[model samples]
Target: MWDSRTPGIPDELFERTEEVPITKEDVRALVISKLRLREGQSAIDVGCGSGSITVELCLQTRGEVHAIDFDQNAIELTKKNLKKFGVSAHVVQGKAQDVLPELPQVDAVVVGGTWGDAGKVIELAVGRLKKGGRIVIDTILIETMYHALAKVSELQLADIDVTQVTIAKARKVTTGTMMLARNPVLLISATKP
Candidate 1:
């Protein structure tokens, strides 16, 4: 696993618009580390908002990456970002629960943001995952966290773990450097038994 302290994607690499939230580099690094994807191993990125995480995943994995988003703008941004990075992926514009079943079984599934149906998405994703495949979910709300946990239990995934990443960055001030706290995000990860 790459050091979490090392940056994954610079904040400036993406063109953010239309309130599409891009994953910060720190959290992106955490998710990628947990994924542990290898060359020629396929993965899916659900709710790929600004495609920042999707781009990073594309760079890491030589296999096919399916970036799914319900929003049209997010779909376009993901395509643009992939083009900019000179990597290839199957950018799908649709809900995860619908798109995942159509795609081939993958080695990894990442739920970066679920649109209120965390359990259903988890259920669908786990069904499509190969044996011993890894699933990493990023949840910001308490409700989503609990829902995902319940699904993980129902699925009986092994090596289940959760990490809350609360990052603070240093900013230049007139007098000295100051710390600025970013919103905390929970990373709920597990592997198929």
Candidate 2:
């Protein structure tokens, strides 16, 4: 059902206006740089919003992708986005903590947005990964970042790293003056032993 031009999606996905929407370009680059996805490797995107990354996962790797989200509207949007890109992925509508138990082990996991249960979800995600598997998570809140760091430590993951991404754009303050607008993101990544 999922092909290069087919977008596998539903109609009831979630909608978020406050956050910057992830684009295909973002997904493609991230998958290549961060995940280094290989052919036949499996991946899961927890809290996948609009399937931007999920669809990219499908495209970059020949492996199957499991895309999950709690919001029905976001799930639907993910479905639409996947179909629009002609990629195929399994889109699940449910909480990550609840669905992790049902999925088979995977090679990589990406947590795009945690809905308040980051620690528990990360534990489960790490547990379900194959040995040497990778986990990448993103957070805007320092509290969440700390919690994830602790969890990775508890899990004994190696090569732990946290990076801050700042994007600044120039906005016109006047005809000759401009101001810089900044957006920041925290990315944490680790590898299971």
Candidate 3:
């Protein structure tokens, strides 16, 4: 079992200058571990948000990373994080489904926030993936999870794995600590046959 309590990249490194969503360090750790990234293998991150995942991917792999998001502010924030970490990625400010076709074939894909386009993005990503490549999706919505699972199955991807993670943290109260539950997230992963 992997513990996300400690992340390779500390959460404080990020500068949340703008109002944009960022993946928590713990969840980012799990997603990175599950992707099984290799050195020099290309990866794409759809809905990169604040580039928390993008920065981690860049640090974890020597391969090229294409970070895409529909929000320009999110793209800028991603760029800021990448710069802060002294890493690089192709940050594109556009809808993932529209920009995915322009990206090079990749060995891995991470869908962190699809924005109601999980099915379409997964379908496109799988098609653009190389054989033996992996796709990992993180969704907070059951509907999105179902859509990703169905699409991965329909695409005939192998080694399908789905996990629901409910994480709680101990917050300090006046006298002692209390358990504070974060939103549960579903992780779906598959490999191109």
Off by over 4 Å in 1: 1-7
* Best lDDT among the predictions, by candidate number: 1
Ranking by lDDT: 1, 3, 2
Candidate-wise lDDT, in order: 0.87, 0.74, 0.86
Give me the candidate number with maximum TM-score: 1
TM per candidate comes to 0.94, 0.82, 0.93
Q: How do all the candidates rank in terms of TM-score, highest first?
A: 1, 3, 2
Candidate 1 residue-wise lDDT at 17:
84
How many residue pairs clash in each candidate at the backbone level? 0, 15, 0
Q: Tens digit of lDDT per residue, candidate 1, span 1-193?
A: 2322333777787778867888898899889899888877889899999898888887787688888999999888888888887777888888888998898888998997778899999998888799989999997898999999999999999999999999999999999999999989999999998
lDDT of 2 by residue, 28-84 (tens): 354345665677899999888767778667866768899988888778887877777
Please tell me which model should have the higher lDDT, number 1 or number 3: 1
